[model samples]
Target: MIKNFSKLALAAGVSAAIALPASALAEIRIGIAGPQTGPVAQYGDMQFSGARMAIERINAEGGVNGEMLEAVEVDDVCDPKQAVTVANRLVNEGVSFVVGHLCSSSTQPASDIYEDEGILMITPASTSPEITARGYELVFRTIGLDSMQGPVAANHLISLEPKRVAVIHDKQQYGEGIATSVRDTLEEADVNVVMFEGITAGDKDFSSLVTKLKQADVDYVYYGGYHPELGLILRQARQADLDATFMGPEGVGNKDINTIAGDAAEGLLVTLPPSFDEKEVNQALVKAFEEKGEDPSGPFVLTSYTAVQLIAEGIEQAGSTDPFEVAEALREGSFETPIGMVSYDEKGDMESFEFVVYEWHADGSKTAVN
Candidate 1:
């Protein structure tokens, strides 16, 4: 549930007052920030579910450093402005580590605050390269960057040997950024890009865009945006009898797209993190999520869980709750997580990450393209 920032502040102050004594400081607070209410709240659900489960399992085994974990969740609404507000709220509430601000647009700005305030943050879903390019020791991600994912998508498209392609974006940081990456990569491969266009994020009617695609006679159309707009575009393009195949990055890989596009979603290709839930090692954890009626297959779920596990392990390895020390530990250590064995470079970007292309189904299932 979303909470007013003012009310969160008041509660934080009261909780701080009652928990001031050293004896009462038996909780390690983890700030879970994301869109608790917004267009992308479904993605936020995966993030929250993963982090919360990690905390529960970790505390069940034995509290970290003999202190239980406490979750302090804040809704940024995926708005960059609101992200700043929630970041301050986290600092005020004394969160040592954070797992969130899912959208790259929000994550980038919120990270600035986290760095300045000494709060360690690991985003499970943000893919823009700029978030880690700033050399902020406190900022890290459990997912790959647009640079990695864009080329993967581009290469797959190249293998198709389409005569012409159209790349489209929603004009947002996460959307346009990845779209640009894909366009650049496709150009480098000497693929003919027929058109590169942008659409408003919340636009419902895409008839004009469909006409353009149909006029371009593009063999494949790549979209860089979230599911909502792309879903409408997919449905509209098909309605206009545009035969070009549609492809997108993880943002548009959501199942809700199926509701919007119906059978049109079936042929859409998506570049997403590998299905970690399918890994043999993660089956038990997958079962755990299923037991709770949570779908663990969304790309961000295990990544978020890994982010929380990394934070806890980093603290234990550093033998301190200090954010800086924990950040150092994260950088210096290699971890076996549900996503994979993860290690960070100097910028805290994962050393090696892969994005797989999957064919989405109308029923919300996906099969990785061989």
Candidate 2:
């Protein structure tokens, strides 16, 4: 009887051990939000690819302080309203850090949610200056703001000395904001603003606008919007036989612009982040991205990789997974990333960055303007 009892006790102990929760094996979840299924999906793809490369490399190197990193993607559809929903989901799921919501409109709303939930958000591409100026401690960005790029593009236009410059937008937060900035900067520089107007995005036809521009005799057209709207305008303008140089902000930097506009997208002048992949500063990250079959053409790719690196560094500095601690570390910390050295001011904007002018060739390739 005693021998039978001893065996039963041992059997019960083994069963309990087997059923114990293996919580330690769960990965540290980081939220990655962006437009996964929308007109701006390409931006999300670039961001996700950059993040995946960084996460894979970091995990291979043993991850953040031995804790494996896992990214949870939340598609906000690039809409501001959806961004809030995604933000809540991430917070409820206990994700302490986030990277995303590529559009300024989306990023702005999502940032409010993150701030309220105490989650740290580092945007790799959202350039609306208003995002960081809100004084949200939980929000940060690794790229230059529209305030910077607007002047850079305006200066590039000044160099060209176009007889008449026309500024227009798609009426979205990003488009209108950038248009306002560019217009104001050019006006301050005494550059003639021949025509300024806002068009609705996704309009299939812009013939009326193009006809008006042709009548205005605009020499150079500065557009403030993404490629879809800009592409259509350019294509329609060419179809109408209007000859004017089309210039835009970094919003027009995707290859899809040319795909949509076809031959009309030729000679598109825009301002974007200096080509980091070509610089020695991004050698390591560039090699890793190439190994994973990811193209590094989009400037935000390096910035996204750097965002993850910054988060890891912040975690290490804070010595905790607590969101507040990590955010504190990020605010006061400076870390070298793929793009360059990254540090945040009290407003959570990058302390170092400069814009560059680029020209899109007829073949959908970009070249930095000298």
Candidate 3:
């Protein structure tokens, strides 16, 4: 079930005004920020579900310090400009911590606000290396960054021995960063990066780009972008008889890609985080999703769960509702989460796991290839 926190209000002194000044209203307030209403709503929905599930499970077992966890969600629309506003709003609302601003573009700017406000922030799905490389004390992520995933995909492509590879990007930070990394890695491997280019996001026609690839005789095309543009590229390439196998980053590894590309989506390959379904420990999580009528196998669910668990553990260690103490706790140690053991480096970057290779089936289900 979907829940929104737009209407929640925090009372500054309500905790102090309680009967026992020592123990306040007993509500641990956390922020949930994401693209709750936009082209990337699915990502936000998956993230929100994981957070909700974690909170429900924790509450059922008795919340931390005898306080119930209350998450207030703010929609950032996955836009960088809007992200700053959302971050300020979350801070203004007196949330103890935050989990969101999903897109890398959004995460980058929103993180500054979090640091300025001394609020703890964690992103479950934004994988761009730049997001964490800033060395902010308050920012953290549950997933590995593009610095790892980009090269993994590049190495995979190089192993396939494609004669000529073409690279394209949506010109966004997340997309372009991954594409540049892949292009550099492929070049390092002495692979022919025949065409490296950037295309506008939300482009309707990729015929010109496809024609250029066909003329270059490219056997493989690597796209560092989200699913919608990838779908259009694949469909247009097939229609133009470009005949190149499409590859993309995890951002493009969604069932929605299949819906957009249909038959053209078949045989598409992508590099993403390791399969969550393959982990036996996540059976309960899968069951929880089913009980809530959500698909546990979705892209961001496991990571989202990990994010919430990370925050909850931090809260527990801090033994208080103060965001500063929780941030200190998170940076000082690791949390054993559903994704695995997650710990932060000095820069608040996670030294966690590697990305996985997957082939998107015609039906949109992914099969692990690596």
- Per-candidate alpha-carbon RMSD to the true structure: 6.0, 3.6, 6.3
* C-alpha lDDT of all candidate models, in order: 0.94, 0.87, 0.85
Give the per-residue lDDT of model 2 (tens digit) for 28-49.
Answer: 7788888889998988888888
TM-score of 2: 0.93
For candidate 1, list the clashing residue pairs, or say none. Answer: none
Q: Compose the digit string of candidate 3's lDDT tens values, residues 77-122.
A: 8889999998888888878688876899999999888888888888
Q: Which model, 1 or 2, shows the larger lDDT?
A: 1
Residue 196 of candidate 3: its Cα lDDT? Answer: 91
Segments in model 1 whose C-alpha atoms lie over 4 Å from true places: 1-20
Report residue 122 deviation for candidate 1 (angstroms): 0.4
Worst 10 residues of 2 by lDDT: 19-28
The TM-scores of all predictions, comma-separated, are 0.94, 0.93, 0.92
Model 3 clash number: 0
User: Of the pair 1 and 3, which is ahead by lDDT?
Assistant: 1
Give the number of the best model, judged by TM-score. Answer: 1
Best by lDDT: 1
Candidate 1 C-alpha lDDT tens digits along 153-268: 99999999989999999999999999999999999999999899999998888899899899889999999999999999989988899998999999999889999999999889
